[model samples]
Every structure is written in structure tokens, then in C-alpha cells.
Target: MLRSPKDPLSFDSREKIALFIDGANLYGTAKTLGFDIDYRRLLEEFKSRGYLLRAYYYTALVEDQEYSSIRPLIDWLDYNGYKVVTKPVKEFVDQTGRRKVKGNMDIELAVDAMEAVEHVDHFVLFSGDGDFRSLVEAIQRRGRKVSVVSTLTTQPPMIADDLRRQADHFIELAHLESRIGRDPGERAARAAERQDRFARDADPEDI
Candidate 1:
């Protein structure tokens, strides 16, 4: 059974809520649990709790690529209800002479969350980065409830202990699979579509 609004972990139907999704982080977490998030279901799940003020999705895009694997999902989110924030990935050579791509959206997420404090009564962050612990505490101090969504069911645990402890509520993503996970058949269909696109885009001689 779901807890009542009186519970610190539960939401009051009247409160204003906003979702901040760390796209890469969330994708990695869900993949570890062998599931894919159904964004439409995710939005509905929260909208049922309160007035959903906004659903923000943050990601880093490789601008140099002619076609990015994540472009389709980003476009879908933009067309849907999500507020997508994207930045270009920075590529650099590491000390060991290995190429690496860096695109951390922590600052952007934090800034947006802080800006929402005046309008939102609840903040739902979809990332387990321990770095957000301080941000969670700050939001709580501002008198807004903060819920951190991530999973601790994996071998190494996807959530940081500090972040989980700091949040007013810690929602394990594994527990939400049934509510927001994509159906296996639907996932297969999407996968096949992506493969077909890839095939069509490839050079005929390479096929």
C-alpha cells in the first residue's frame, strides 16, 4: 500500500512537483536491472501524485556525429512532455593516450533544481551521484521535499549511500519497474526499428 501524504516519503496531491532526470545516469542504472524506462508511464506515475510542474531530461550530445544513437530518444522526449537540456560532449586524450568523452550535466541539473525551488514543492531527482547529496540537503532546507530515485539492488549498488541518506525519500528504481518499465515486446519492436534505420544508413558496399 502507498503511504499517505503525512509520511515524509509520500506526496500530497496538492503539492507542485518537478522531475530532473540525469539521462545517461538513469539509462545506465536501468540497463543494469535489465529494463528500459517507458517515459510516458514515468510521467503518468508522477502526475498522479501531484501537479507536475516540469519533467527535465539532461544529456550530452556528440555534435561531431552525423547520427547519434541517442538522437531518436532525445527527439521523442522533446515531442513528449519532457524538457530536454543538451550540451556538446568534450573529447580529449587521457594521460594514458586514450580518447575519452566528457559531458557531466551536474551543474546544469543543480542550477535548474535551485531555480525551481520557488515554484516546486517537491523535487524528484533521477540520479545516484553522491555529488548531489549537498544539493538534496540544500533543497530540503528550502522547505521542498526531495526524492532520489536509483537502485541499490545491483551487485555494486547503483545509488550512493550519502545521496540516499540525504533525500527525504529514496525510491529504488527496481521497485518501480512494473510501473514504468517498457514491455519486452515493445522494446523488441523499437530495437528492430533502430536496426533497420542503421542498415538503411550504412553504405551498400559495407552490407
Candidate 2:
């Protein structure tokens, strides 16, 4: 069973904390809020909260595509403070002969969280997937406080009731928007610059 923290935890330089982000889930949530995540700001926000030992981001990439909409964000996160874990998205033919996209990082995230539990005082998870309820239970058993960062604002609730009830604390993502949301004008200016550069340095195959 999961239990709530008795008190708000403090971030001493010695308090070990690790962040495990479910990339697709987090991206979906952020997209719903109409903004790109400023990973740098995300890192700084947590670093100020505790001794951040690691920040892991997990995503499945659709390889063999000419271009992926999420490629740039993945690249940016890789070069930044995040330790990005990516695997090629698997495509399978279903019984109905329909193609299905198969890419879930739940197992991977759980494994990492379990491995890091002993090393960290606090574990922060950026996902609302119900599959993680057991993972949270296991982490809590290790005596490490686990905080689930998702939202209850969306219809049907973005967080699973079981998971929320099990966590040491629940942090609604809406509360962190001001700390992580990218400025619209700044994003627009960057996009415009990229378009201009693409036009100027076009290759025959690049188009």
C-alpha cells in the first residue's frame, strides 16, 4: 500500500532524488496544455528541490520514417540534462490484419526505479499510467518516498485513483506549468529561424 508523506520534504544538498519521466505520457500532457517543455527549466526546478542524481527520459521512436515530429525534442533532451532512453517502435500485425504500434516503457521505467530506490531518498515519476501502480507500491516498500506528478484536471482524471492513493504525494502538473512551460513567443521565434535556415541550406534530398 502507498502512503502520503507526513510532511513536505526539504531539499538538502544531501537528499538524493531521481526523476524518471515517461516521455510519451509527459509529451501528451504537455501538448494538452499547449506548450513545449523547457527541459533546462525542468532540471533547474528539481535541482533546486533536492540533490538530483539522475533524470531519465524514456521514449519509443518510430524509426524508418523520413522525419518524426518528436525527433528534435528527443535530440534536445539527449544533449541536455536528461538521460534519454529510446528504442525503435515495433509494428505488429494484429489478428484483424491491422498494424499496431507497440512501444511501452513501463517495464523499463519500473526496473530503473527499483534499481535506484535504495540510492535515492525521493523518487519522482512523471506519468499517470495506471500500470505503474505496482511499481509505486514496490518503491514505497523500500522506504523511499515516491511522488507522482500528473494531473486530476483532465476529464476521467489524468491520474489513476489507485496510484494517486498509493503515492507519498501527488503533484498536479498544472501547478508546475509556470516552472516548465516554454514561452510561446520564444518558441515561435526559434521555429521561424529554423525555417529560414532550412530554406537557405536546402539539399535536393532534404526537401
Candidate 3:
């Protein structure tokens, strides 16, 4: 039997894989590397490598704001085959009376990963947060292969040494730039295509 070019990707016998993208972390990593993520291409590249079970993207939103900076990206991902998880940003004043916002999605991400362990054969994590070291170890103990995607190419590496060491396999994001990064030429076209398209932040990864 021959498989046609139009055959559904799910019909393949490849290992089942799930992607867990820490939105803020990924944005920062890519920013440091000087490129934007072509999320469509990222999903396509992974789908080509396996039977993609799910692609999860986690982020935090400031509900008080009339319009969020990342709203367009979140909406796009939700409509384009991604399971988007979001929570409101928590704002509080510190001991110094300085106001700060906290929106770590670590717990949400961990709980989701654990729940998905039974259904997936491989887990691909896209974040450098050291806190996930334990989560990776836990997932590995459940007999699933875990791949951590982050970069060590920067002056100060984006990935944590502990998390990198804990993963079954470490994939350097820098290596996948050409495959998943958005094209520089497309920036103008994309901007013109949609006024709602979100622009990336110049600051480091947060929330």
C-alpha cells in the first residue's frame, strides 16, 4: 500500500508525541537568538516527525488591561490546532512597596503534563525553567521519553543545567531556528495582513 501526500498525519505509525510550550520562556529564548517563531512551521516540523497527540501553549494575561499584548497570538494559536492555557496575571506590592506582577504557569504546565503522560509516548518541553527538572524526571519515570528544547549558544545559556541534564534528550533551539523561526521578510507581509497580529516584547521572558 502506498501513502498519498494528502494522507492524514495521524494515520502514520510514528511514536505519539506532545508539545508543551512555555510561551514566555520560548519568546525570550527566541528573542535572545534573534528570531521569531513561525508557530505554523513549528507544528508542521513536529507533526512530520511523529503522530502529534497534542500541542499545548501556556501563557498569562493581564485581565485588567483593556487589550493584552499577547491576545492576538493566543487567539491565533487557539484556532490553529493548539491547546492554549492561560491565567490572569497576579499583581502585588513587594516588601519594598514596588508593585510586581506574577504569572508563572509552572503548576498548570506540570499538572497538564502529568495528566497527559499516559496518552503520550514522547514529551517535548520548550522552556529553560529549572523548576521543571523534577517534572521531567517524573515523566521519565513513567516510561516516556522527554526532550527539552532550549539554547546553550547564548553568552549566558537560556537553558538551566539541571533541567538540561534531566531530560532524556536535549534539543538546542538554536539548531531549529531555520526550521521553526519566522522569516524576516514575512514580518512586513504579516503586519500588513492583520492589524491584530501581536508584536513580540523587547524585554526578557516573564509570566
Candidate 4:
């Protein structure tokens, strides 16, 4: 399934592959597809492709919250197969006194990718941010095949044109959903329970 315009299919198994996951980017894509990812399946899917050396997940957390929405997902990934990297999102007031959230993991992702370039044979990035074009180019310069994963189904699509063009292979997120999507019956049951909870907590007028 790993066809490329660059190299032939004669590459060996020791050709190490690494996954650089942009947490927010991947979350948004999955949310758009209406399913949660089965991380175990995702890992197995890639392991079948080649030697998987590492899977790195990067995200910024909102500090000082009583509870964060992403906490459970982060914990799950940490215990699973991923190398979870997180940093607290900084809150600052701009010159106009508007509160702003600053949490960009581009530098961290780039550094890790560069460090792994020496040993990795393939790089798979789970983001569509155009800023990574240069980083992808750097990896390609080292003769590693770079695969970019993001959706092409949305109105404007999630991937940047230049990034898609630069990658050796561009895998759309939709194609991967079947392998990671939750069962529809289970999803409906969960939604019904959530709605029931909301109804029990609210006045009839509020509904």
C-alpha cells in the first residue's frame, strides 16, 4: 500500500519509521469525521508498513483548570504506545488587553523530527499546517520518505497545497477512519445517555 514516486518498493525492513502527531490537528480531523481514534489499531496499521521506531504526540495544555477535556486522551496515549509530550499553554494579555492563548508545538516537533532523521527511513506527520513544509523538505533532503496525513474532504480541506505537493505520499484521513472509527451502535448509545443526562439536569422550559 506504500507506493511512492521517489524510491522503489525494494526498501528493507530496517528502514525505521517515526510518527510525529500534531495533537490538536489530529483531534480536529477525527472530530470532523465523528469518531474517536482507536490508537492501538493506528499503531498496528503503521507497524505493518515498516519498522516503527517511535510515535511522538505533542500538545499544549490549558493550565489551572479544575478539569481538562484532553486529560483522559493524553493519559490513554501515554499508557499506550505513544511518547506523549505536553506543555502548559501560556495565557497572556495582548497590547489591547485581550486574553490570548499561546501554545504552538512547531519548534518541539521540528526538533524531534530533525533528531530522528539520522536513523529514520520514513517520517509520517499528522498535520496540515503549512509551517512544516520546510521541516518536511529537511527530512527529504536526508533521503527519507515523508508522508503527510490530513483530510481533503472539508470545504477548504485540512492540508496545505504546498505541503501535499512536497510529501512523497499524501494519505487522506477519511481512508483511515474505517480502521479507527467506533461502532455506530455504540456511538448512538453513548449519545443517548448524554442526552438523557442533559434532560435530567434541565427544566422542561430550558429544553
Candidate 5:
């Protein structure tokens, strides 16, 4: 059941909404929650909640690799109504002689959110990073409601307290599992599903 608008976690169906997903952070949070997100379902679920203006997904690609595991997902999102933002991954060696990969999309996401504030009534941020506290505050100052989606049921908790405090709403990702999650078996069947679906959807005229 939906809560009253006075509730901290309630969303108004008439307000325009946009989703800002931190690709890596969301993946980690969902993995900890023990489910795979059916992105197509996620889009529909949010669209049902309100007027979904746009969904932005951010990630870093390892361009050096001939095959990146996330490439297929990125491609799928690009074709399926998501505004996908990406950059090349930076490889470096640390002071301790350990290899490291740097790929943070915070600045990109913040800029987009700021620009989107003029049009969106509410912002749904899919990340637990405390670094976004200031960003959330800034958005709120512009009169847009901000919802932080992350989990608090884990051992150490996935959400940053300061970030959660700054948000107008806290949407527990775990609670949304039934609405957005895909069965783990889907992965095992994906290859076959892809082949069959492709053959069925492909047209000879297009080919």
C-alpha cells in the first residue's frame, strides 16, 4: 500500500521524476541484497509510480579489453530508453605496488542532476555514497524532492547516514526486490533467450 504524501518515503504520482543510477554502486548494492535487477522491469515500475522523465545510467568501460562484461548491458540500455553515460577506465599502480582502477562518475551525475532540476520534480538517486550528501542538499534547495535508494538491512548497512539524512525520502532497495528483481535463473538462460529473441525480432528487410 502507498503511504500518505506526508510520509518521508511517499512519492506523488503527478510529479515528474528522473532516475540517476550510479552503475557500479547500484550493482554492488543489489548484489548485496541478493537479486539481479530486471532493468526493463525497473523502468516500468518507476514509470508506474510517476511521470518518468528520464533514466541516466553511469559506468566506466575498460577500453583496453577486447571484451568487457558490462558491454552487453550497456548496449541493451542504450537501445531501451536509458541515457547511458560512460568513460574509459583509468589503470594505475599505487604507492604499495598494487594495481588500481579509477572510475568515478559522481561529477557527471551531479552535473546532470543540476541541469535536470529545472524540469524534474523529483530525483531518485541509486547510490549509497556519502559524497552525494551535498549534491542531494543542493537539489533540495532547488525545490525538488530527492529520494536516496539503498539498503539499511545489511550487516554494515549500504547507505551513508549523512546522505540518508539529507534526502527527502529513503527508498529501501531491498523492499523493491519483488518489483524490480529478476530471477537469478535468468542469467543462466540469457544466452539462449538472446538467440531466440534476436531471431524472432530481427527482420529480413532490416538485415
Candidate 6:
């Protein structure tokens, strides 16, 4: 059985910690696991573990759009103690005549982590990208601990083996589902509230 968050092997309460969340990666992993992360719960979980110096969330935004699906989540995170870093996604057409949006925030996250190392004793990286292996190794060299949060419970696994091995500790996201997962009932309630609001705003003639 996987250990819980309270397990001593997971974190040191006395240490100063910082969280680096790769937003897109985390969302993809959680969706793959058939769950949604309650960001409030996730922050509270780690805050209870140690002195949470910072919690940084990174993502790419579709700038030209009048509305983005991610905007609300980003706003919520920003208002609720998370430092959000975002950049406009670049749209391009390939030789195959397919359009694509590129918005990788790996470099931004790495730079922030490196800058934060001086103030934090523990780094909790919420990403499965193997490209961060070098960043993890560098942080470890600074005499601080690094804990990676990703899941291996999925068929192909969400975490990269190289990145997993590079970290000083690995905390499977599956083990944290109980603490950070969103309640289905809460989601239903929110949906109902939205429906009620829509009904209130509806035109009588349209109805």
C-alpha cells in the first residue's frame, strides 16, 4: 500500500517548502485518473506539512480568445494563494497544413524553482515531464530535498522514470486522491447553482 501524506517519509514539517505546479501536466494526469483536483485542498495538505513558502502554478493561455476555459481556474488559483505564471500561446501552421498551439512553460517553471531554492528547503514539483530531471538534480545539489508528485497507477504511468529517479522522494498522486480530490457532490451542487443562475438570466420570450 502507498503511504499517506502524514507519513514521515513524505515530508518534514520543520522545513520550508515551495511547490512548482506544471498546470497542464497536472490537469492531464488528474483527468487520466478520472478525478479533479481541489486546489484549495491541495494547498492545505502541503501547508499542514511544512512552512509553505510559495505555490507556483504555470500555464499557457489562449490570448486572442474572448473567453478561455482555463481563465476561471487561473483566477481562482491567483486569488487563493497560488502564484500563477502564464504566457500567451503561439499559434502556427505546420507543413502538413495543420494548425497547432504551443505554450510550453517548462523554462519559466525551472527559472522560478531555481530562484526560489535559496529561500526553501524542500521542493515539491507537480509535474511528470522528464525534461525537469536536470532541474531536480540541480536543486538536490543545493543541499535541499526534492519531492516529486505524480502517479504511477495509470496503465502507462503518468510520471517519467528518469524524473522519478532524479528526485529525493516520490509521492504518488493516487495516494493523495483522498485528501485533494474534489467531491462529486460539490461539483453537482456547483452545476446546479450555475443552472439556476442561467435560468434567472434567461429571457421570458426565449423560454
Candidate 3 similarity to native, TM-score: 0.84
Over the stretch 5-104, how does candidate 2's per-residue lDDT look in tens digits? Answer: 3322334566788999999898888777667788899899889887899999999877687788888888998888889988888678899999888878
Candidate 1 similarity to native, TM-score: 0.88
What TM-score does each of the candidates earn? Answer: 0.88, 0.85, 0.84, 0.81, 0.86, 0.92
| Candidate 4 Cα misplacement greater than 4 A, ranges | 1-14, 92-100, 188-207
Question: Residues 1-207, candidate 1, lDDT per residue (tens digit)?
Answer: 225323324678999999999999999999999999999999998999899999999999876888998999999999999999999987889999999888799999999999989999989999999999999999999999999989888989999999998888888888788888999999789789989999999999999
> Tens-digit lDDT track for model 4 on 13-119?
67788999999998888888677777888888788768999999999987887688789889999998999999888788999999988878999999999998998
Is candidate 1 or 5 superior in lDDT? 1
Better of 1 and 2 by TM-score: 1
**Residue pairs in collision within model 1:** none
lDDT string for model 5 (1-207, tens) is: 225323324668999999999999999999998899999999998898899999999998875888888999999999998999998987889999998888799999999999999999999999999999999999999988999999888989999999988998888888888778998788879878988889889996865
CA RMSD of each candidate after superposition:
3.4, 4.3, 8.6, 4.6, 6.2, 2.1
- Model 5 scores a C-alpha lDDT of 0.90
For model 2, the stretches where C-alpha displacement exceeds 4 angstroms are 1-14, 92-99, 201-207
Best by TM-score: 6
- Candidate 3: Cα lDDT at 64: 84
Q: Local distance difference test, per candidate?
A: 0.91, 0.84, 0.87, 0.85, 0.90, 0.90
Question: Candidate 6: minimum summed lDDT over ten consecutive residues — where?
Answer: 1-10
What tens-digit string does per-residue lDDT give for candidate 3 at 1-207?
Answer: 113223212223478999999999999999999999999999998998889999999999876888887998999999999999999986889999998888799999999999999999989999999999999999999999888888888988999999998987778887788888899989978776664433243333531
Off by over 4 Å in 1: 1-9, 193-207
Which candidate order results from sorting by TM-score in descending order? Answer: 6, 1, 5, 2, 3, 4
